[model samples]
Target: MVLAAAGCSENAMYDLDGGAMDAAVVEARSLEIVGDPTVSLAGGDTADLTVQLRDPSGAPLAGETVRFALDGRAHDSTLETVTATTDAMGLAHSALQAGTVVAAFRVRASADDAASVSFDVAVGDAGFGSMQVTPEYVGERETLPRVVVGLFADADCEDDFVRRDPGDRLQVLSEDDELVRFLGLPAGVSFAVAVRAEGEGGTVLAWGCEDRIAVEALETTDVDVTFDDEPLVVDGSYQTTSVFPTTTGEDVATALEGARDALLPASDATLILDAAEATLSGAEATELRAARASGFDATYQTALESLGPAAAHEALIDRLRTELTSLTVVGRLRATEGELDFSVLRLGMGAGELEVALTELTIETSLDATLDSEELRVSELLIDLSASELVRALATREAFDRLLDGPSAWLASAASCAALPPPEEPIGCDAVCLQAACRTVLADYWTAALTVIEALDQERSTLELDGSANVADLAGDLQVDTLEGSLAGEWTGPSATSPEALEGTFSGERITPPR
Candidate 1:
């Protein structure tokens, strides 16, 4: 279990300058629990808890309302005072009664927007045991941020322990060389232990495994896990020789059209119609009229006009296919996880005045090895889109006007106007107000676009290889043979979305030594 500490929460009030406003105008800046972080008590024992609330300059904030809540089951554990106001010392107090059951729980103290902290409480006799793990290689290297310990059922230590469920694991956020402990584990069971050193970006740098250890009730199990002398690494390059046949231009067009229509909810139709009347006229107004009669194709044309012909959308998909089939992918193995980065692809229209940029695709790989089985599972793919850049370039009012070539100019001669002219302006008319609405419409369009991009990001495909190697080999140049795999859409285990196993072979070869 991770013991959380009280941290400072930002509540900045800025004046006209970027500098912070006066501290008197700010609320509580931090909230800290003053009692012990861990409490061990027999059943029916009571513990008093106190929290302090402070302002920006570390001054006491008196009379502020503080709230207390329980996180997990402490059996029938109850907090006597659920709420309390701070005293002159910025402290608030509450009491917790340890109930008639043996369980572990946490008490959380919070106040308004101030940061919160939690304390672990265990109410039991001698039935529970603790595991204390120390890494053997930490003294020889730099400190890491976190150490993850997993208790697995595999006695021989063959299973992928990193992917195990929550109840059997402990992740302690700390600097290297600190002893990590897991409390409240059931005793008298022989289990394997997996320990990994997590560095920046949560990357596993070193790992060790030990098997067949028994724990005794009411006592602490001390174990030392020996990790790699140094972090393992691999550098290489690979590429896809062929694109997935199922990926099509029609799919791209359908995604774009769906994103466009989602922005025009029924309630906003009247607002869009009024803005359209004030901004679009002459040939453009007539174009929309004839298109809306054709059904859903009308909404597609409305957004597509600024993007050019329907064929342009198809061309972009063709470019995506070409880039995947031809580009060389750079890869690296940072300890256990393998990452493949694809080259950036640029899809453009209107002589490159409007462009959408596609960046790298990262593929995570896992190696499994045992006497009976040796395989590598590569999945968890993410395709990064230039959504923010696209919004700035194409989803703004200025871009709309540039693409349509000043449609508001034709509004002057139009007979029916949905809005009145602004004061002190004759020809300005509702064109300015209509433009403001146009900004809202475009903002909604990009919001929908971002939603589509997020879904696309989660859409993963899987591939597998038929063999694995010792973890030490990852520090040098490593290569894998051609392997067959499957392609699927957003697969979580097996379901309707899982596709048939596709026929293809891709291999990897390392190019550089460990970084």
Candidate 2:
């Protein structure tokens, strides 16, 4: 049987016999304009435009050809029709150049039997101008050796006015000379210029604004920009000391006196005749006898005799040191922040030996403070404590023991003392025993680590931080995956100085370990 064939519409489905089928068909449904829809340009400047085509299902329609047409109240001879083929992503690109006359125009992109999208372009007069930027150094070699300059229509430098039409801003690289010149700017327009070094992010090294620059029809307007390069140097030091709650001076003194009384010999018969005669009178001897008969003495005399008075004093000092924590920080300021290097040391003291548990860290931080309020917000904190020296110091001390052993053992001892019944005396054997044990252990394990110091650099591994301050009060929180910690304390001294001076007492606790 022979069948008649029928032609299909542009987007209609077809059968094998070339007959129009009733099946559903997909067609281009939308045209989207990409890039900047509104552009400002000086006469003779050209800008690229893009259009995107999509099917009824919102999927890109590729391999399609799109034609562009320009429309305006008064058209220039340079405005001409152009065509571009859509790529795999359905994007078609075309270029438009402004004419010598200043006017506003619209460009439309259309596909065969598809919706069209339009973009607006504004053209200014053919007049042109130039700007000359000169660096005025406040001190010797004040300016950076290399910098990039950006000219904007607004004072914020957020909008690039010099190159508003097509290409990047006119960024002149300042080399041997201090003057950088930008040419071909839209004449008679006010502009704000900002100078900054590469890799500085958005920090502005220098900035200025030219209110107005007059450019006659064919003549060039020359504008001069002078920027002062002033170097700001800020350096300071801060110190802090902290005494543990359970190991205060008053507690230690009472413990020592109780220990002495407990160790005294009891009866005249049991006392060493010669030793007692030399150290105590008859009345004192009777009192010592009374103290021994009472239950207050337990191993006190044996400990005193075995360790000796000097060793006992040394042990006490060592114990006290272990309970004390201190921190010292020094920093040099740059821009809005400062680079700080700090060390926290837990001191252990003995008769003839001294030991320390040390941790060294470096951080970049900024201080935000005002005279009106006592609160100071500390921000932009980047910390690093991964130097080999820091590792070695930590390895030699008990500061990191919390990571391995969990909560400190001293805390447990303190809890045990708290559980005991209140004694008639301020201090008793339970507290004294724990303090003595801590002293003995520290003395036995005392060893010094070789100190190694190195300059701080940003390339090293660093952690972020958040903190706050109030006049003499300060607190900081460390943020890191493997380590969690905090620094809190009070400080005193001059608020603002060349090298801002600070004296304070600080305490820190490690919540986690790197391992």
Candidate 3:
């Protein structure tokens, strides 16, 4: 997220080389401040300073780093230093210690552009005095709040347990060395908190614990502290790499370099991913859960329409079923009565654009289809033409071309039915032979027509064709009315799936061919 001001210096904003952006990137900017030199400070105590970071516009700057300094000194062993990192929320905190202190901060642009911000702050005890030590680590059931947790820490109360009042209070409690102050917590947890020492004990003034807490089943008692007199007590306060039962610290660190054999390859582990698309809904999730068993992949695509014919169509379906049964989610666990479903809500390509994109073969089609898993129920499907290109395709076959060459060739070849019994021919072998020859000649036509009909009847989906009434009966040189019940003019699928044979009737006049 970038913050910008309406009127700020042109140099206020510059692009960062690579950063995590909260939203779209339109501008990059930061804030700068300069304070009057009158700020005062006290010795041996800390104060507070605040800096505003904003974008090129007067708007507050976010994600800036403000280093703290007094005089021209840096974090050398000879000098002390304080620093603050700006947060996404655009706030920075500076610690002021006792003594004559002047506060200032500088921001340097990251790898992207050369941009920077610098500000000066005057320091003094002219501010509030308090110190609060907060636990840095919080796990399940952890009560330490991240907000303003250290706002009221008392600087003087060493060896004190910081407590937040039930009603707007935070204070260091029990700094007396005689009694140890600690917060009582439950079992099975770890915590990271700071403990201070006020007494004149050792050369080491006071120190804070490390980040993060890792506790086994806790003894379920209060947090305790120990002195350098018996430094072994600090061992109870923190866990080392050599935690009792786990491999020693050295072993685990070595494990990162493959020195230890405990690590497993990513592919060897069983992974069950619970994935859901953003467009999917709760109902879809429920349906997906049903498919949880086995290796089903629930997805929807309209590509099935590209399957050319029965042989290819069946083969594609078989592959889909096989793949579905082989995949698994949730580590091979199966759900009974699952529904591996897909929806047609996605784009429909079978109509036109999709057909062109799918294959090299030009599918002269008028088929529009809708199918579900239960049955190949179709809303509409049709075939358009059995014209030249089509006839050649079918007719190229050695034995069956005539049957595929459109209804004209079909009618001509089968017209032997028109012949009547020859008078006086019954007694002769020639007469008997004529009937047999006609049957033999038309045998292929009957087989061809029956094959087409059976396929249409058994097809689970619809197939519409645009067969025009212009097909000419060559023998008579006349165009017959379009085949009525047989639906020669176009393809159609079952009207109701329950009775698969009942299909929509296809009728047409001598329609003009498409341009």
Better of 1 and 3 by TM-score: 1
Each prediction's RMSD over C-alphas, in Å, is 21.6, 18.6, 32.0
Q: What is the overall TM-score of model 2 with all chains considered together? A: 0.34
lDDT tens digits by residue: candidate 3, 212-247: 332222232233332111111100010001000111
lDDT of each: 0.46, 0.39, 0.26
Over the stretch 374-439, how does candidate 1's per-residue lDDT look in tens digits? 233444333232222322332222334334332132121121122322223222223455445444
Q: Whole-model lDDT, candidate 1?
A: 0.46
Better of 1 and 2 by lDDT: 1
Error of 3 at 429 (Å): 99
Point to the candidate with the largest lDDT. 1
Considering lDDT, where higher is better, how would the candidates rank from best to worst?
A: 1, 2, 3
lDDT of 2 by residue, 1-515 (tens): 00111122334432211123233322435667787665557777788888888888888889999988764321452443388899999998887877766544456677765545555555666455556665443322233433444454323334454322211232334244556554445455455555443212323333343433344444444555554432222223333232212222223334444444333223211222223323444665565545546733453434334332233334433444453222223222222234433333333212111123233333333343221112224443333322223223323333244342211222223223223232244222233433444333323222111111121112112323344433321111111111112333222112312211123332322232212
C-alpha lDDT of residue 187 in model 1 = 51
Regarding lDDT, does 2 or 3 come out ahead? 2
Off by over 4 Å in 2: 1-96, 99-126, 135-146, 153-168, 198-206, 216-259, 262-314, 318-515
